[model samples]
Target: MNVLPQSKHYNLTHYQQRYNWDCGLSCILMILSTTQREQFLNNFEAICKEEGFGSSTWTIDLCYLLQRYQVRHEYYTQTLGIDPNYTQHMYYSKIIDKDEKRVTRKFKDAKAHGLRVMQRTVDMDVIIKHLARNGPVILLTNASLLTCDICKRNALEKFGYAGHYVVLCGYDMDSKKLYYHNPEVQDGHICRCLSEAMDTARTAFGTDQDIIFIYEQQQSSDQ
Candidate 1:
């Protein structure tokens, strides 16, 4: 098992709770925040021990591999010892229905008129809507690309994909800039050219129509 720094390990746990999304950026932030590199290596060893997995090299790589494997492995269920079928049913009937439109005809009677639908909004739109509701939405997004930023080019080179997920905490329609919560940057906020954000939004989330409106909990809302 490899040791990982204290700060890095905590960052991974913290970001997972905060972002609640699947993008590797949370893990990337974990690596970036730990000041003690050796301590960071130790943390990976701890994770492997708890997960009952081993690695050729005990380092952050092992932590990454275990987490990824657990997501798909049947052992994930065996360890929990709970049938996930009910959860899957609830996921389809309730959670996903609330967030996304289910267009698959198999879900309905054959003679019913089917409707074209869109899925959930991209990360930016969700964050923006949160701000609208709360008047100061603070959210993290994994940004690995920028059209003009020099650092962005380097990130792309290393990551082999421009699939950066950026936070849009707020938007200024008049100024045409979107504010972001970027964990990778020392600065708290990064301003993106609106067009660039739009382009990224199109690539990251294909449609604006499926934007999930944040209705009041008491409000009767149906998809």
Candidate 2:
């Protein structure tokens, strides 16, 4: 249970979602806030609209945006056994359907923009490792998984809001608490028990696994 010495939180009031379904975009903005990237800050909405990220944003949409802005990043999701039905349930169930072929195209677009993307199944250990290194992770989870009572209640009222995203910024191992930024929450940060955080993250896609997006700034020399 290693924790960062201090919390890394970001205030992204300006980037709050204009639509109820833009949590994914908001989460990405929160991560970009950490880097203090002026370009993204200046043209946030334009970038989102250009990428066609409105009601729902997929992993590839985020990767493409990051790559377009020259932000180095990677994406991760637990690998599940080959189950076409399960895949349909997770992605195509929505009104805005995304098939494997569409998803693959998004990945190709991101690569074309020069973004490094990777998808793999990872355990809590891997997540903790990233937080230990002071890396902010974008976690896709059910909005109800949030510890905030108001947030959970709102999620219940909104249809199709079970799927949401948040940024995990830090943890206090000594206190066994996890700190994160909820774009839906007005407050800058929210704190909950480490166990609760993990439990909520497990609700994603009913897989009880994590869908994580990690972004590392590319060194100028590397570019």
Candidate 3:
């Protein structure tokens, strides 16, 4: 395991997504906030629309959007392929119901943007390492994983086992706790034990493992 940092955190309360479907967007905003980009902070929805993010957004969509903005980023997943059953369910339930042609076009557009996407099982150690490097991650997990009672209730009522996204901003290795910016919760930030975080992360629809979106901004020569 890598040496964990004592403590790390990012203030991203102002970037909370207004719509339930905008969690991914909210996480993107949180990441951009770290760069202190005012344009993204001021025009979130317009930027979302420009990125072709609809009611239901996928990690891939986010990757493309970040690439368009010249944000160096990648998405990590436990599996290289998506589960057939989950894909069928998403299509049938209209969770990702969209024009096939349009979706294909958007995917191609993202690919052209040169976004880097990687698939691998991630753990607490990896998360902590990233935080130590000052890289915030977009974590995908079930709403039940959150410590807030209201977030769990909302997750149960509105999402119901569906995947959710949050920003992992800090960690306390001494306490074995992970901190995140959860858009669904009232306070927007939650902390949980490492074990609990891992358990709830497996609640996602696919391989029942962890998936994350990470991007580190490149520093300029002038600086």
TM of each candidate vs. truth: 0.32, 0.70, 0.74
Report how far off residue 168 is in candidate 2 (Å).
0.6
Estimate, for each residue in 52-159, the C-alpha lDDT of model 3 and write its tens digit: 655667667767667756767666665443433665674324653453444556545544667555556776666677766746677666665345322343234444
Q: What does candidate 2's lDDT look like per residue over 13-82, in tens digits?
A: 3345557777777776765645544666577678766776545566667667666655555666553222
Highest lDDT against the true fold, candidate: 3
Clash number for each model: 13, 0, 0
TM-score of 3: 0.74
Ranking by TM-score: 3, 2, 1
Ranked by TM-score, the better of candidates 2 and 3 is 3
The segments of candidate 1 whose C-alpha lies over 4 angstroms from its true place after superposition are 1-127, 135-160, 187-189, 195-198, 201-223
Candidate 1 lDDT over 74-166, as tens digits, reads 000011111234235532234333322222221232123222122223455444444344322222222333442322432344432222333
lDDT scores in order: 0.31, 0.57, 0.59
**Clashes in model 3: which pairs?**
none
Error of 3 at 40 (Å): 3.9
After the best TM-score superposition of candidate 3, give how far the Cα of residue 191 lies from its true spot, in angstroms: 4.4
